[model samples]
Target: MNRDAAPWREDFRGGSREAEDRLFRAMAQAISPRPAARPDAAPVGTDRADRRLFHAKTAVGITDAALMVDRALPAGLVVGHFRPGAILPAAIRFSNASAIPQADGVPDMRGLAMRLAIPAGGPHDFVLANFPTALARNAEQFLALAMAAAGDWETRLARLASRIGLWESRRILAHLKASLKLCPSLAHEHFWSASPYLWGSRPVRFELRPVAGEPPPPILPAPGDNALRIEFASRIARRSVTYRLALQHYCDERRTPIEDAAVDWRPRAARPIEIATLVIPRQDISGREGRWALEQIDRLRFNPWNAPEDFRPLGSLNRLRRFFYAAGDQ
Candidate 1:
């Protein structure tokens, strides 16, 4: 932690206020650092799009979807864009979580980035992941991990051991290995916010689960790099895919700490209560209109900070996310 300033401390409640500046610099360097000169070609690194620090792989699909807020929900859960009986038009992008593009067979984190078109104001974004918890606890730990990853085998191992220790590193590795296995289809997998957000005045975590009665995705004899996309296309060609959007409210600081995103609050907190539904319509994204939609979506930036004031993101990790994401856009 840098611990050199205190002015921005008020914005980040229970956050790593000291590490924010250092984290910003580190993220900027990691994403698009000045490169060594080349003999004939342009500079080694200049393109921001090509140098995205994470989740830079091809999107599995960028299609239209709708979010229907439940009309029968209790009055308390109805806040922000989740107004009862509201039908919000949305666009969703499914992606593999890797700085470099890899095959679908590879066991890695997956992402579900969504943007809702709100009639009241600007689009609200939700960046969800297949994993229920983050690998790092805060911006400082994330910076250390990123630094360690840039080193060689021996140096990386030593740095990991020293920075996060052997047991914690091993635990993260095991968790990733078990949870990030090859997905039969993106539509079947659940997506979690993993971090907290302010639901009006209260903090809450959200997730999306596939609706019941959809047939299981086929077991490919040998899945290719686009296996997930292929499965989704085949299924959507026949019928629409739907999901239940639910939220788990915060309990207490000890059980559902706002600062630590690495902790899974599901164990101690109450089960998630359903509030809305998401439906991906049966349409061809492979055709001309679909291609146009994909191109437009790829050009758009989806950040969790693009939300209503009442639904602002919480925690140090999210605070770090807000800083870096906004910085990247600039």
Candidate 2:
């Protein structure tokens, strides 16, 4: 990792230290979510209503005979079931981040949720990500913002400004400006977990980026409500998609805080060390196998907290997620 001074290190105190553990749990429970229909149920987010989801229970594993390079990770950071060379069965779900479902052409945060069953038949490892590698707000801040969206957009922004400050409001607006922009295709877009996590015991973050030198996808029809999903599924039907799963360690507290969910580490610290790959093969969702897969995806929960002990999610955002995620269990 780069030894150069990271100017953002001073802000690295937001992750675990942001709140007392119990307090975060209390805050999550205070929301008073309805009892989940299932043991592992949880909400996708504060933003609910008029939402649309396009899902596929595709398999995931490391690339076939691909090179495995380690970044000198400590044993604690090797994450038991997710070591550099491990591979397992996995499923994925894709959706748009909006309280009200909008057209795929509409600008909105895009999401990718994946669930990988452990080798020993333990709890599935779930990793949720956004197209942008960074988040605009932290735990409490984001919850407040999403809640406000239930009302009018103007009201949401104004209320958020009053709660978090005008400067933050502007910063968030700018961040979303880029984050919500339409992507060429879901298969072509890169995804990030955004929040940091414990790589075993060490602090680090992970992301899945498209591998280079692949054939460029063909252009599709004009913008429509479910355009992204349609195009993604169509492309997959023709060929498989692959992404590199890489991890970046925390060099220093200031450079890479473990508690803050809003801070973007590795911006100046160092590049991610490629550890594994994710390959999603083509499938016809209209067929019997596809229908069975979709049913499975809908029945289970997809939360970052679903991982094993070594891969536990870190930071305040994760803490806040404790209750809401379980609430979605069904």
Candidate 3:
């Protein structure tokens, strides 16, 4: 084990896993009163159709991609499916991080969930967002936020203030506001894991960045509700989309705490190093293969824990996510 990771390991071992699980389960329940059901086959835009409490917006696109590890990667950085020159099949899903489907022009967080299929075990999944940091620092705070999210905007703010105090609630709201960006295209945005994960015994963060030198597509002056989807599909139809898969190694507990995810570990203590390439070839997502891919995504659970032991997620929030995702899967 990496000696530098001892503090986080000890902290994780000291926590009450059972208690955390119960808390997350309660969070899941409070977020969505409806019992968890199988992924619905209903079409997008169906009112309150999605069973997920968060990121309920239907996927814009689900397509086949390829992850090619850099051939010149250092031997020490090569582990699991990170072998040099290896090309792994990947499933990529793009969507809005909103329970209510809204116009693409509206400010909201974006999501990218990628699942890479390896030969050894279950597929490894990376659930990422455009934001580099999360609003809540721990499971308890996240539960409070979840409870607040179950209501309308006013109700959410009032509930949050009541649960976590006025000042803290306002601070979280400010974070939320800043995080909700209005990116013109999903293909042009950068996505981050936002939480630390084990990278061959070392805690690291992951990111997906658009390949350099590619000009972003033009944006609509007045975007429609499905504007983002339209822009992404138009881009895919014209040419392939490529991203550099990068990693940010942990510096220390102070700068890269494994437990606090709200901290952005960039321009401070760590720098991102490109390790692999992700290519989404030009394709017609409305075709038969595209339809099949979309169906598969609907039935899938894009949990960060759907990974090998070496890549297990770290932090209290991630631990809570395990149970929260499990509860949603029920």
Candidate 4:
């Protein structure tokens, strides 16, 4: 295999890869740490899945707009209750995904998880990721990668594996390629819901594509690691920025596979349909306000499974994720 190229890079050009559910589950059972409480006692906790620490995180208002589903879709185990022209209010939080909470230049992933803030009901949390696609193929691979990052002997072993030709090393390489992105400003980066989620009954994916503004010039000096955060703060303080909330429906098992999270939708032919518009208004997040924002969100659970009955997250990776971050009373 070419050292610079991945053998499975073109794998998604075919159809969906069949998942080994039992294999993933068994591995999870063996490696999954025993929670402080029993699985039934408390399914989920305030503890994050992997990205355990963050900064420059804040909530922004989502306009009360209609989410027009382009096609006829169902609810219940899907984008539940969401249809063409259904009015809703939403909010988003921007954060750095670092378990050890390192500096900005340290190669890591950033995230933007949104949630519907309804007046009389619960919220549907949405994790819009910075990566175009996930670094692992299935639940088993995903778990291995998380364990490696979770810190401890596992992390050491994972790093050692990367130096050798091991399966875990492949995942590390994928993580490096997918997560180490050029992010000078939030307005320039396109965020994705890398894993597949139920769009009504059909399995589909979501993306937050930047609709305006060009990337900061490459010749600009590196203003330190928190440059993206500083730019984001400055952007919001000056004016609102927009990102097209779009969806990609399943076309085939290969091109739009439900199980594999490692491949992006190849050939950017049809731009995804714009379902809703995310307008992030300018605001201040310094001093007490920033601290308060962090405190409030840090206490709340922000898993992708924090959605409604209609929008059930699918695939093995999500299943394992749900296992790690369920929201039972603690």
Candidate 5:
């Protein structure tokens, strides 16, 4: 929306033109209509791990939010040490998936965007969700899915009419209809990169596992209570969770295309997880120190395209993102 600050338009040339056009079109359409809402499915299985759902209603006014990457880190876990490379100081921000800053304890898959300053090499960045895999694979698939989900009110009415017309004649039609759902509220879910990326010569993927503990205590509303703010402040004060950063690598030659986000790479050999610890220290969210830290860290941006050649993001989604994200920011 900030035309002058638009980085995509200024840098648009070479391979990214088509993606840029598609993104703009999608944004335009998304703003024009009331999309249909899908019915929630009945809870499926008894397995709590698979059936648990997290949703958070965020508070207003915070434009963006971030997690301090190193504040709770386990000692000696290195940052920026690629094979044949040296360590570098890096900063990261974690936010809710919707891009708006929300109260901390809301159920959502935390969003993490990291920026690593590479001395003598370009900075490496990433945009990630907490899941182990993604719902869609490529830019085209993602675009189509998003468009279908954003169908206007008339589109929804037409669909309903069609359903009614075939009601008596076709029971299968009812079962076959696909429902469109909005992106899950990030607070209550975990996200994944869903695509493979390079880490040195090995191909790898990342996941964010929440710290081991029961969920934070529920917030009680009072005369002046802001539930999310209070929960986040208290949790920061108590320092409740600890998450481990882990990586999975591909050893099979068949996984080399590295250009499709949809295909699951079968591992010829699997390696044990190398752990990196993340810890958050206690602090007052509104205090000067907390505010300054959050401002400096949260405002930082992470672009997956900003990596050394050996570790570059290589899939269709990554390529598409290289353009669209830049355009959106621009």
Candidate 6:
């Protein structure tokens, strides 16, 4: 029994013995790799279909261009909507995802997690990563990947020996191996919902795509390389680019298999993508309003399980999150 690990009793808090065992088994299966004998499947493009579907279903007055906005919810802010036309204001925080204590200029995935107060729809919260798909599908898979990446002393020594042997044996000539490092700038990177969820009346996933243009120049680390931060600040100052929230729907089962996360959604089966523009205005992070917004988002809880009755998350990851997220909240 690893003392650092969570207890089995904790896992069974509100369940019977049978249920606990089943959960443990499911967790085990999620962490294990798929057998090599199983070949990978094809990708799917569902965003196009979702766009067409959403447009067709919306009321006559709701034009595709109407969804664009010039400002986002404020930092650590909450907004409530009482009536169809009524608007309530709130604050929010935008930062890098690496958890490294640094300005937004650091090369890493852009994390967009926010909490919004809706008078009618309950609290709205979301956490998005820069990539369209997550590195792992579920919590267990996440754990396994972390463990694999965290090589022990023996593993490190073995890798070193292999490199040395290769060099001595002349097996490789001038191998230009790039070191595994996080990116410094996130401006060009697009954030994604990662997990699939039902969007409005249709089942779909969401992704933030950058407008067509070159990102700011790269800023490598140096004695005083605060240039990345400067670039980020300048971009916010100019406010040139506006992101589009593209929704993709699943149409075909064969190409866009729901069970696998590695495969991209097939474009062939994809519905037209409905786009919603998001414009972020510059705000002082140290200001009282910004602090308030950060506090609100941090204290507030956001889960896919908190979604409307019709829009449930599907697949093994969703099922696992339903249990674990609830437990963590408790």
Candidate whose lDDT is highest:
3
The runs of at least 3 residues in candidate 4 whose Cα sits more than 4 Å from the true structure, single-residue gaps closed, are: 1-87, 150-168, 171-175, 214-226, 267-271, 327-330
Candidate 3 worst ten-residue window by lDDT: 37-46
lDDT of each: 0.72, 0.59, 0.76, 0.57, 0.43, 0.41
lDDT of 1 at 280: 92
Candidate 5, overall lDDT?
0.43
Best by TM-score: 3
Q: What tens digits encode model 5's per-residue C-alpha lDDT throughout 1-330?
A: 222211211222235756554554454344334321111111111112111111112221122222334343333233344322233344545554433334444333455555555466555665566554444455554444444444674564344334333342133223223211122222233335557666544556765555556354444322232444455555556543444455556544345235556554433443425354433444566677656655565433445666666666656556555543333230
Candidate 1 residue pairs in clash (backbone atoms < 3 Å): none
Q: What TM-score number comes out for model 2? A: 0.77
Using all chains and alpha carbons, the TM-scores for the candidates as numbered come to 0.85, 0.77, 0.87, 0.72, 0.55, 0.55
Clashes in each model (backbone N, CA, C under 3 Å)?
0, 20, 0, 13, 20, 36
- Give one digit per residue, the lDDT tens place, for model 4 in 236-299: 6666676777777666666767777877865363246666666665566444665565455555
Full-model lDDT, candidate 3:
0.76
**Model 3's TM-score against the true structure:** 0.87
RMSD of each: 7.1, 5.9, 4.4, 8.1, 13.2, 15.4
Please provide, for model 1 over 69-119, each residue's C-alpha lDDT reduced to its tens digit, 9 standing for 90 to 100: 899877777776677899999888788887678888887788888888888
Predicted candidate 2 versus true structure: per-residue lDDT over 42-83, tens digit per residue:
444323322122222222212121223244433444666656
Query: 117, model 3: CA deviation in Å?
Result: 0.6
- Which regions of candidate 5 are displaced past 4 Å? 1-80, 83-90, 99-109, 119-122, 149-191, 213-229, 251-272
lDDT digits (tens) for residues 106-203 of candidate 3: 88898898888898956788989998888887777787887777668668888888888998888888888898878788778899999899988888
